[model samples]
Structure formats: C-alpha cells, structure tokens
Target chain A: MAVYTEVPDDELAAFVKAYDIGEVVSFKGIAEGVENSNYLLATTKARFILTLYEKRVNRDDLPFFLGLLEHLSAKGLTCPQPVAGRDGEALRMLCGRPAALVTFLDGVSVRRPTARHCAELGRALAELHETGKGFALRRPNALSVSGWRPMAEAAKGRSQAVSPELDAIVAAELDHLEATFARLDLPKGVIHADLFPNNVFFLGDRLSGLIDFYFACDDAFAYDVAICLNAWCFEPDQSFNVTKGRALLSAYHATRPLEPDEVAALPTLARGAAIRFLLTRLVDWLDTPAGALVKKLDPLEYLKKLRFHQQANDATAFGWRP
Target chain B: MAVYTEVPDDELAAFVKAYDIGEVVSFKGIAEGVENSNYLLATTKARFILTLYEKRVNRDDLPFFLGLLEHLSAKGLTCPQPVAGRDGEALRMLCGRPAALVTFLDGVSVRRPTARHCAELGRALAELHETGKGFALRRPNALSVSGWRPMAEAAKGRSQAVSPELDAIVAAELDHLEATFARLDLPKGVIHADLFPNNVFFLGDRLSGLIDFYFACDDAFAYDVAICLNAWCFEPDQSFNVTKGRALLSAYHATRPLEPDEVAALPTLARGAAIRFLLTRLVDWLDTPAGALVKKLDPLEYLKKLRFHQQANDATAFGWRP
Candidate 1:
C-alpha cells in the first residue's frame, strides 16, 4: 500500500501528451506491487497501468523487464504490453523516476488459489518460458544458488532470533543445496523468478494474465517450477498438498515436457527455491527499520517450507513420477 | 494508501453474492483514502468502490456517513451513491469490518487546483449543502470550535516542537475563537467539514463529483466555506490568493446566498477553521505512535494558515462583502 511520490496534474498532463493514447481520463495509485508505484491510468481511449520505478528496481535492468513484457505479449501471452509513445519509446521519465505505460490486464489475483488455479498458473508459467525463448536479452537470476550463500551469511547468526533452530536448519540446507546445485546439468531458460499467486491474475477460473516481471531472469526452468510449487501448493499449515502439486506439474509438463534429468532435479530445485525465499525474507525481517512503509513478510513461513522440502527424497515426493 | 484488512477470496465471493451487481471481474487495493481499506472493484456490470472502514472511523457513525451519501445522491448531487444489496442493505460486515459498495465516481482529483476548478468546487459545495438539507440523519462536527481545546491541551506544551511559537499562537487563537464562536448566530446546516481539493473530482475543468463525506456534519455553512477557503485559496508559499477566494465565494454565493451575518462571520470562521486543523494536526503529530502506517501531516502548515487568518478583520478580507 504505497504511493511514495505524488504526480502533479500539470506534469501528468505533460507526460500524457507524449503518448498516442487519448487525453487522460483518470489516474489512481494502485496498492498492488510493493517494488514500485503503480497507477491504474485511464485515458479517453483505454485503461492502462502507469508505473514509476522505485529505488528497489535497478534502472539498468528496466529495459529487460519492459522488453520481456513486450516480447511475451507479442507471442500471444496474456500480459501487460508496454505501450510506446508517439516517438516509439516505452520508457520515459515521470515524477523524476523511470516510468512506463502498459496496457491494463483485466483480472483479479486469487488469494487462496485452488488446484484448478494452480493448474492454470502452471500452464501460464510454461507458456511464459516457451514464449520467452525468442527474447534476446539475458539477466541471470540474482537470487539463484550463487546468491544464497552471501544472503545466508548476512542473516547467519541473527536468524536464531527468529527461531532457535532456524540458523542450523538454514546452514544445513545451504550446504546441501550449494553442493547439489553446483553439479546439476539442467534445462535453463527465461523464468519468472517470482511467479507467486499474487503476480498471476484470474478472470473467473481461467488465468487471465501474468504480471510483475521485476524478478524475472534467465534461470533453470525447473527452478521456476520449484518456485511455483513453494508458492502455490502449500496450505495454511505449511504442509505441501500433493494433489495441487501433481496438477501444477502435469499441466506444466503437458505444455513443455520436462527432460529426465530435469524431473529428477525437482526436489533439489524446490529446496533451493525454499531457501532462496527463506534467506532473503530472513535478511529483510532483520534489516527492515522498525515502522518502515513496507510490511516484512514472516521469514518463519519459508523456514517451515524448507523443512518440508528437506524431507523429500525424490521428484515422486512432489507428485512428479517422471 | 491503506488496505489494512485482507479480504480473503472465499469471503469476498460470498459477500459480493448478496449484491445485485454482476459477478466480480477484478478487485485491486487502491492507494487513495487513509481512513479505510479501499478497493477498486470491477464487476461485469460496472466499476465500484469497496470500502472497508478502518478503526479511525467510529462504527456508530457508519449509518450517518452512508446515509448522507445516499441522501445527497438521491437529491441529485454527483457523488458516490451507496449501493444497496439484494436485501436492500447498503452496509454489511466484510472481513470483520463495516463495509459498503458505492457507485464509482469518474474523474481525477487535481493535485494543484486552479481558480476555475475552485469555482466549480464552490458551486458543488453549495449544491451539497443544499442537497444535504433533506438528510434527516445528523452528526455533530466533533472537530468544530468546541472540540479544539481538548486537542489543544494535549498538544499545548509539545506544540513548540513543530514551531518555536506554535504553543503561543495556538493558545491565543483558541481563546479568541472560543469567545468569538460563543457570541455568533449564523445559519447552520449540513456542512462538508473536510472539503479539501483531494476530496473533489474534476473532469476537464468541470466538477464531476464530490467524495469523502466522513467529516460531514451539522455546522455553520460559512464554516464549510471557510474550510474551503483555507484549503483552496492558499498559494504554495502560504500566501492567500484573493482572486481564487473571490472566485470561490462569489460562485458559492451565487448558488446559495449567504446571509449578511454568515458573510460577516467569514473571517472569524476562517480563523477558527485554521485553528481547528492546527489543534488536531498538532495532536496527531504529538500522539501518533512512531512507525505507524499513516503519515502525520505537518502541524506547522496549519500554524502558518492560522497566522494568515489572525490578521483578517472582516469578510472583505476573505474577498467577500456583507
């Protein structure tokens, strides 16, 4: 729930003049994305989203994010297409921040996603990966296996404050994942590194759109699947629901068949996914200044998820028997 | 920028089932109002605003606020009409908070309002006061003249933290306003006590709608005018712009002719209005828990406005003549 910068009327009018979209009808700050300021912008022609990139987003990586959306939408994906100005530039400046206008996708994010929603999301995820094949830009996933150690070390001693045994569990998991990830040869491609349910929208029971491509990068496709498993298949009790896991994996497999090695690597990738979130969240939980605008998600939630992943011996444990 | 309560999907689906409005298409938390969790709800029929009243609003006062909106809309004022459910109830409990669905009003709020906008707002405000006459439900202005002292007392000694002489200015203004308000007899009616520019919507220089009636109450109509004058007729540098003041007053007077007494009391009411905000803002500044979600407005801004009002001797000083 943030609108850190207020856009003045004159400045907005001037900014809209650069676009081919008709006169601005209405604009409102949307409390959806946490990483940037998002506004539901309506014009005489159509509704769009106006995003002002905040400090958390690296300015250099914006073209990759914007370009990926353009590339995906062009490949028949239901995503926000970056609307270019009359000069054909999608990115511009507004309120002294990097800004862009994208066509609005019509759907609501499902809060408690069912197996059916997970299935639809799985199909969409596979479509995103397949569609992303043609995109030329490459950004390595910063939160991948290589990134975990530094984050875990930063939160190493302090993680016990969250829970007495958290530090030891995280340390053991880090060692296991680091050793396993270094030796794996897996199918790699563009992946929506943070394809959580909140970033996927549903119109009725159908997946209408996928959004918030900020965390997207070039990474193992199985890693993206693992992220979805952690995000979508878990219940309130932190127990993994195998039925939903099977639904997500089978739907994803139907779209793009996983290789034998990729299937075998699922459990390890899922463990890495859990630790990736757990370590980052743990660091954020400790580092966030008290009373900051953003709410720090509970790191212990991912700790519980990591514990579940630790027990899984094979891909069959995740309902994938490839 | 507030969406305090997360309305789960199952609960929202069940809640919307009671409404005659079409099936919900999209729901996004809007970063707009501070006092409530607002969502821009789109259905198959049309867009609507879903407001979940937060703790700042008194539960007992819900009917008055919702009723006033209904009453004003029925009287032909362009404002958000509270949408009644199939059971003919506009108010219901959702996510354990008093909630309501109101017809979405179009148009954007101008950050910097022009005199033309001020004139339109003036006419809309007069229309609101006239329409509100038919509203039977009455809520007293708790932030009016009498409410200032307790708040002033709470922030009295601590006021100097905002400004060096704020305590002295507030003390002097309270005594003056207390004495002046006791001796006044003016026309009283329903007044939108917090008619800031953000609460008024404009579409291409035309006033499209008025909103946020939480502070609407039974008070001297001129006091509402004074609040607007304090809100709208001031420049960024804190100097009063008499051209905008004249435009606002004359337009308002054209719609609802202010009685000689109401006109004569304008300067004093404006002074009291400044102090009213100053005292409340000062209290909020002092009492707000550190790191709270809402941003505490600067009390010194009102202190500056209070100083401007202290020198005005008559209605003519506010660009009005009895």
Candidate 2:
C-alpha cells in the first residue's frame, strides 16, 4: 500500500495532456505495486496504470524494464504494454519521479491459489521465458547467487533478533549456495525473479496477466521455476504441497520441456531461491524502521522454506521426477 | 491507503455470485477511504466499489449509512448507491466484517481545490441536505459540541506533546464553545459532518459526487457549512481564503437559503468544527499504536485552523453576512 508521491491536480492534468488518452475521467492511487506509486488512470480513451517509479527502483534499469514489457506484449504475451505519449516516449517524469502509463490488464490476483492456478502460472512462466529469448535487453539478476552473500552479510549480527538460529543458518546457506551455484550450468534466459501469487492475475482459472517486472532479469530460467516452487507450491503452514508442485511442473514442462541438466539442478536452485528470499526478507526485517508505512513480511516464513530445501535430495522431493 | 482485509479469491467469487453484477473481470484494492477496505470491483456489467467496513466503523450504524446512500441516490443526488444482492440485502458479511457493494461513481478528487471547486462543493452540500430531509433515519453527530469535552479529556496531558500550547488552547476553547453553543439556535437537519476535499469528487470543474458518509448525522446544517469552510476554503499554510469562502457560501445560499440565525452562527460553528477535528485527530494521535497500518494525521494542522476560527466574529468573517 504505497502512494508516496502525491500528484497535484493541475500537474496531473498537464501530464495527461501529453498523452493521447483523452481527458481524465477518473484517477485513483491503487494499492497494487509496492515498489512504485500506482494510479488506476481512466481516461476518455481507456484505462491505464500510471506508475511513478519510487527510489527503490534503479533509474538506469527503467529502459530495460520498459523495453521488456514492450517486447513481451508485442510477442503476444499477456502483460502491461507501456503506452507511449504524443511525443512517442513511453517513460516520462511525474512529481519528480520516473513515470509511465501502461495499458491496464484486467484480472484479480488469487490469495489462495489452487492447483489449477498453479498450472496456469506454470504455463505463463514458460511462455514468458520462451518469448523473452529474443528480447534485446539484458539485466543480470542482482538477487541471484552472487547477491546472496552481500545480503547475508548486511543482516549478519541483526538476523538473530528475528530468530536465534537465523544468523547461523543464513551464513551456512550463503556459503553452500555460493560454492554450488557456479557449477550448476542450467538454462539461462530472462527470469521473473519475484513471480509471487500477488504478481500473477487470474480470470477465474485462466491466467490473464503477469505484472511487476521490476525484478525481471537475465538468470537461469529454472531458477525462475524454483522461485515459483517456493512461492506458489507452499502451504500457509510452510509445508511443501507436492500436488500443487506437480501441477506447476507438469504444466511448465508441457509448454517448454525442461532440459535434463535444468531438471537435475532444480533442488540446488530451489535451495538458492529459498536463501535469496530469506536473506532479503531478513534484511528488510532488520532494517525496516519502526512505524514505517510498509509492512515487513516475516523472515521466518522464508527460513522455514530454506529448511525444507536444505533437506531435499533431488527434484523428486519437489514432486517432479527427472 | 487501506486494504486491511484480504478477500480470498474463491470467497470473493462466491460473494460476487450473490450479486447480479455479472462475472468479475477485475478487482483491485484502491488507495481511497481510510476507514474501510475499498476495492474497485469491475465486472462484465459495470464498475462498482466493494467496501469491507473495518473495526473503526460501528457495525450497528451500517444500515443508516447504506440507507442514506440509497435514499440520496434515489433522490437524484449523484453518489454511490448500495447495490443490493439477490436476497435484496445491501449489507452482508465478508471476512467477518460488514461489507457492501455500491455502484461506483466516476470523478477525480482534487488535491488543491479552487474557488470553482468550492462553489460546486457548496451547491452539492446544500443538495445533500435538501435530499436528506425525508430520509427515515437519524444519527446524532457524535463529534459535535457536546462530544468535544470527552475527546479533549482523552488527549488531555498528551495534547501538549503535539504542541506546547495545544493543551491550554483546547481547554480554553472547550469552555468557550460549551458556553456559546446552546445559545446559538440554528437550523438543524442531516449534515455531512466530514466533507473534506477527498470525500468530494469532481469532473473537470463540476462536482461529481459526495462520499464517506460515516460522519453524517443530525446536526446544525450551518455547522456542516462551517466544516466545509474549514475544509475547502483554507490554504495549505492554514490561512483562510476569503475569495473561496465567498464562492462557497454564495453558491450554497443560492441552493438552500441560510436562515439569519444560521448565518449569524457561522463563526462559532466554524470554531466548533475546527476544535471537533482537532480533538478527534489529537485522540487518534495519542491512541494510535506505533507501527499501525494507518497514518496518524497531525493534530497541529487542525490546531492552526482552530486558532483562526476562534478569532472570527460572524458569518461576515466567513465572507457571508446575515
């Protein structure tokens, strides 16, 4: 729930004049994206999402994100297409922040995703990966294997405040992941690093759109699959739901068959995914200021996930026999 | 920005199935209305607002609020009419909170309201009061003159922490207001006690609709006028803008002529209005738990407004003469 920048009425009117979207009928700040201020903008022409990119998003990466959306939408993938203004620029400035108007996608995000939702998500992920192959831009996943050690170091002494065993567990996992990640030469492509259920929208059982590409980067495609395994296949009690995992994996495999190496590396990649989230969530837990606007998710949730991944012997543990 | 209650998809689907609004195409939690969890629910038929009443709103008062919207909208006042379900009930349960779906009104809320906007607001306020006359419900203003003392007492010692002079000013104002309020016998009716800029929507320069009637009650109509004077006719620096006040008062008088006594009582009522907000905001400032989801509005802003109102003489001071 973020609307950090308040766009003045006259300023917003002026901003809308640049677009061909007609007179603003209704504009409302929506509790959608966390990384940016998102307004559900309705004009005489159509509905669009006006996003003011917050400080958390790197300005240098805006082009890559915008370009990827444009590329994906052009390739017939279901995503928000960046709408260009009369000046033919998709990105502009609003209230001193980098802003863009993207076509509004119609769908509701499922809170408790079922096996069908998981299957739909799996197919969408594979389609995204396949379509992303020909995209021109390349961005390294900053939260990938190489990034885990720095995040762990940042939360070193403070992580114990969240849990007594968190600090040691995180350190061991970082060392293990860092040593093993380089050797696992898995399929690499554009990966939606944070394709949580909240980011995937569904029209009943059908996946209508995927959103929040701020975390999209060039990484092992199977790693994206692993992220999904952690995000979509986990029960509220932190137990892995093999039924959901099998549904997700089977649907994904049917769309884009997983490489033999990619399948074999799933357990290690899943472990890395767990540690990545744990470290980031731990850092957020340690650093979030008291009385801050944003809610800090429990790091222990990811810690429980990490524990499960640590014990897994092969992809079979994830309900996928490779 | 509040979406405290997360509506699960299947539950929401089931909930929407009860309504005749067609299949749900999209539903997004909107960053509007702090008192309730508001979602912009778009279906195959039309767009509507799905509001889950939070704990802050009294469940007992839900009928009056919903009924008032129904009555007002029925009387041709442009507002969100509560959409009744197949059971003919507008009020129902969702996530254990009293919930209702209302026809979505279209318009944008102005961040910085102009004199024209103030005039439109004035006419609309009068229309609301006129239409609310025959409504078969009564809710006494809970934050009126009689209610100030209790709220002030709740924030007694803590008031000074917000400002050095707040305690003394609040105490003195309470004494002054208690003595003066009963003497000023003014026109009484249903009043929109909270008509701040955010609660009123505009299409270009036209007043589109009035909303958030949680504070609506049976009170002095002029006091409601005073609330608008304090809300819409004030500059950001807390200075009273007479031009805007004149526009607002004149437009309101054109729609519903103010009685001589009601006109004469504007100064005291405006002072009362200012103190009413100051006390409530101060209480919220004092009682809000640290790290709570809602943002605590600064009581100092209302403190400044109260000081301005205390110095005013009569309706003439508000750019209207009895």
Candidate 3:
C-alpha cells in the first residue's frame, strides 16, 4: 500500500532498457500489494507490474516465488509470469532491492465476495493446487501450526490491550491446534497460504487471476481450503455465510475431489487456520505504530471468526456434505 | 502517496457503465495525487484516471477544476481531458466523493530536472498560460499573496521548534512582501499555480504533459514563473542552478514575451512565491501527524529558497537578460 523506495527516473529508464520490453511510456506507484513496492510500468509493448521486494520479504525466497510463477503459468494457471531481462534473469537488483517484472493480468478484485465469486475462487484455488504439483522447489509455511506458538507468545503480554479475553482465546486455540494439527494426515501439497478476497481477481463472475504468491508454500491442501472458508465465507456481520461456503466448497470439490480424511478434519483445520490469521493479525495490530501508511487490519476480526469456528464440530457446519 | 478511499467493485462497475467505455478490464488505486483518491481504471476501450475528490478538496470548486481541464484540452494542450458520461456529466458521485474520469496521459515525471527538462517545462508552462487566455471560470488563489499572512500567523507560535530563527525570518519576509506585492502591476491570467517538477511530465527530454490542476487559479503569470523558478532552479544542495534558471526564463520569455515591468518585479514575485509555498508547507509540516500515510515535506527547503530570493534585487539574479 506504499512505495517505500523512490526509483530515480534515469535509473528506471536504464533498468527497463535491460528488458526487451519497449521504451517506458508511463510509470506509476500502485497502492496495492502490502509487502512490496509495486509500480505499474507501461511500455510501447505492454503493461507490467514492477515489484521491488522490501525488507519484510526474504530475499532468499526469490527463486522459489519467481520459479513458482513461471511453473504455474506454464501449467496453464492464470497468474503473473516473470519477464526475464535480456540477460535471461527474471530477478535482478533495482535500487538495492530484489526486483522482478511480471506481465500484468487484467481483472478487478472484489471488495465484497458474492456466492458466485466464492465459487469461482474455490475452483481457482483447487486449480492452483492441482497445477502446482511437482514444482521441484520447496518453501516451508513459516506461519503454519509450527510457527503459531512463538507468534502468540510475542503478543501475549500486549494481547489484553486489544480485548480482555483475547489472550485467553489465543492461548486455548494454540493449545488445541498444537495437539491436533500434526495428527491429521490429510493430503499435502503447495498452497496459496493467504487466499484473501484481495488476492483473487474477478471479471464479473469469472475468476481472471490469482496473485501475491509470496506466501505460497508446501502445506496441507485441505488447510488452504480452511483458509479460504475463513476468508471468503464470512459476511460483514461476522456470521458465516453457509451459501457462500457451499458455493466455495462444492466448486472446489468438483475441481479436485477431497479425501474422506480431509472432509472429517475440516473443523480442526478451520480452527487452526483461524488461529494462524488471528495470531499474525494480532501481532501486526500490536506492532504497527499509530498513523503508519499501511492500514492496520483489526486482528479482532479473526478473533470473532475463531469464536465461530470453535463451536463447529463437523464439516456440516461449513456446508460440506459427505 | 495514499489511497484514502476504497471503491467497492460493484459501485466501480456501475460507475464505468455510465460512460460509453466498455466493461471494466482493470481498476487499481494509484498512489498519486495527494488531495484525491485516484484509480487507474482500464476498460476495453482505453485507460483513464478516475479521480475521487477527498474531503481535503473543496467540493464546490470541482466544476471549475473539471471545466478548466476540458477548456485546456480543447485548446490543444496535452493535458488530461475530462471524459463526460452518457448524461454529459463529468463530475458526479462515487463512494460519496465527487469523482471524474480523465484520459490517462503518457509520461514520467523527472525526479531530477535537467536544464533541458527545465526549458521544456518553461515552454509548457507558458503554453498553458497562453492557451488559458479566456477560461471564463475564475478561482482565487488560496495560497497566494493575500493568503500568505494568515498561513504565516498559523505557524508562528510553534515556528521556533523548527529553528529559533525561523519565526523571525517568516515575519520579516511576510512584512516585506505584504508591503511591496500589491504595489507592482503585472499581467494577470489563468496560471498553473503549482507547477512543481512532479506536476510536469516528460518522455525522455520531450515534455509530454502537465497535470494536478487542483491548485490552478487566476493569478499573475509572472508569479507562476516565479513559482517555477523557485521549484525547478534549485539543486539538491540548496544552491540555485543559474543555468537551469536561464533555460526556464529564456524559453518562457520566447513563448510569451515578458514586459519590462514584469521582468523587473521578478525578485519580488520570486520572494512572494517562495513565501507562498514556504508558509503552506510550514503549515503542513506542523499539522501532519507522525506516522501519517502522507509524507511530510521539509519546509526548510523553501526557507532556504526564500532566503536566496531575499538577496536578489533584480531579474539578473534569476539569469534574466535585459
């Protein structure tokens, strides 16, 4: 949501010269993508997104992320393809930051997801998983079940500042997830660990693209489904929209059938997903200074979702039929 | 750069439908223009800048701004033209803010202005004034000579915090300007009062376009030139580049010959122009909260420029020839 680094004009023109893309026509910093400074760079040829990887993102993960986009696009998934320069390198240094130019996809990200949008998202999510098989690169999900404890502990002292019961809720969820998460031996593969509504684009009812794959990593496939259910199936009033859940789940099932164990483990996976987001959002809420450029998303929103997931004892609660 | 408002997807789609442009292909919040939430809206037909006027901008003054763009574009200036909808209305409501779509111009703003860039900017500024000869609507410059004293007084109390000498300098400058600014009779017309380097664009060395007309108002044409000299002639080290000043004033004078009286008042107008920006920037520097999305510019930069202008008693100080 902010362009932290200001690329000099002559430097930009020189950098763009390395690529086969024609002369730079217009360049603008886009108020999009939280972790990186994204610019819409247009040339005589076409428009592309120029991303300067900020310090928050690990530079070592560049190959995996850039390669994954290349691999996914080759597999017929609609995603940004990294445009290699004349030197045959996709990732290079721009203003002392790891940078990449990606072909821009055209679509609008829905602010409020309809049931139809959810269904399209589910299909796309399943397709991403299906196509991401055998990528030959591995990155562990750093914010998964193994990472929740440290995150929660860091925010524990300051947790009560958000709400009186936030600390207790986080502690109990962490305990429950740590005991049950590793036990579930569901299908595992690469997943877009953060598939929020903002990450998926839609052209009317049709899903056009999936982006911000920096979070994509090896994880339980069903865990990604749980992430989506928590993300897209909830209304503004904090109630789960079962119709949206059905649309999302059914479409996903139609694309790639879920295993019996995966279906049975929905309640646990959903709760763990809730805790994953709750802890991170809580840390961010507590860490971000007041009046920072980036808008702090309320961690309590996930706390409310966690409360809802706590009572669901079966897949039926998520509109998943056997 | 920040996007203050988020336009919902459906609202954006319905809004674009009002115009004859095809369905929305892409919509992104642009981190450009401080007073408005600008989105780069792409349809099947073309790319356009959709500007939603935020609360900082006066809503009543919108007609004058939009109408001015239309008038300037009609006069063959390479400025953004306000695109009217099917109902022939360019200004309307979007997300409860006054909004209009203007054709997207192609160019990059030079971060470091060369003598060549300054020459191009001068020509473009002179062209804008010449083309704006008979623009019927008139909006008083709110940050001009008449507006400086109030702004200076607003920042006077806390001026010592910035520097012990700051308050005295502002006081002396304001007194000198108020005494002399009214005595000079100069050619007055519509002027792009805020023609900073960021407001002017270039494709390589060729001047492409000028934008951000929120500050355009009826004022002395030489005052606008003085504003440009203050903006474009200064180097990063706070030294005025006489070469750049010569290029700018020479090119501008070639376009619209400056009267001897107007040339003689360059030092005073330049001082007043420096005060205008210095006072407004001082207010912004003091008023903006820490960690705000909008970056606070250093007001002392203009203070240094004002000090330089204070010593210049003739146009020769600005590289003007008799």
State the C-alpha lDDT per candidate.
0.88, 0.89, 0.91
Q: Could you give the candidate ranking by DockQ, starting with the highest?
A: 3, 1, 2
Summed backbone clashes in each candidate are 0, 0, 1
**Which candidate, 1 or 3, has the higher lDDT?**
3
lDDT of 1 by residue, A1-322 (tens): 5776778778999999999899888788888788788889888999999999999889999999999999999999999999999999999999999999999988878878899998998899999989999799999888888888899888878877889888777778878887997678888888999999889988889999999899999988988999999999999899999989998999999999988888888889888898888888889899988877677899888888887888888888888856
Q: TM-score rank, highest first?
A: 1, 3, 2
TM-score, prediction 3 = 0.97
Candidate 3 overall lDDT versus native: 0.91
- Model 1 lDDT, residue B122, Cα: 85
**Which candidate number has the best DockQ?**
3
How many angstroms is the interface RMSD of candidate 2? Answer: 2.4
Name the runs in model 1 displaced over 4 angstroms: B289-293
Where does candidate 2 stray beyond 4 Å?
A289-293, B288-298
Q: What TM-score does chain A of each model score against the native chain A? A: 0.98, 0.98, 0.98
lDDT of 1 by residue, B142-173 (tens): 98877888887787777777778877767777
Chain B TM, per prediction:
0.97, 0.97, 0.98
Total clashing pairs in model 1: 0
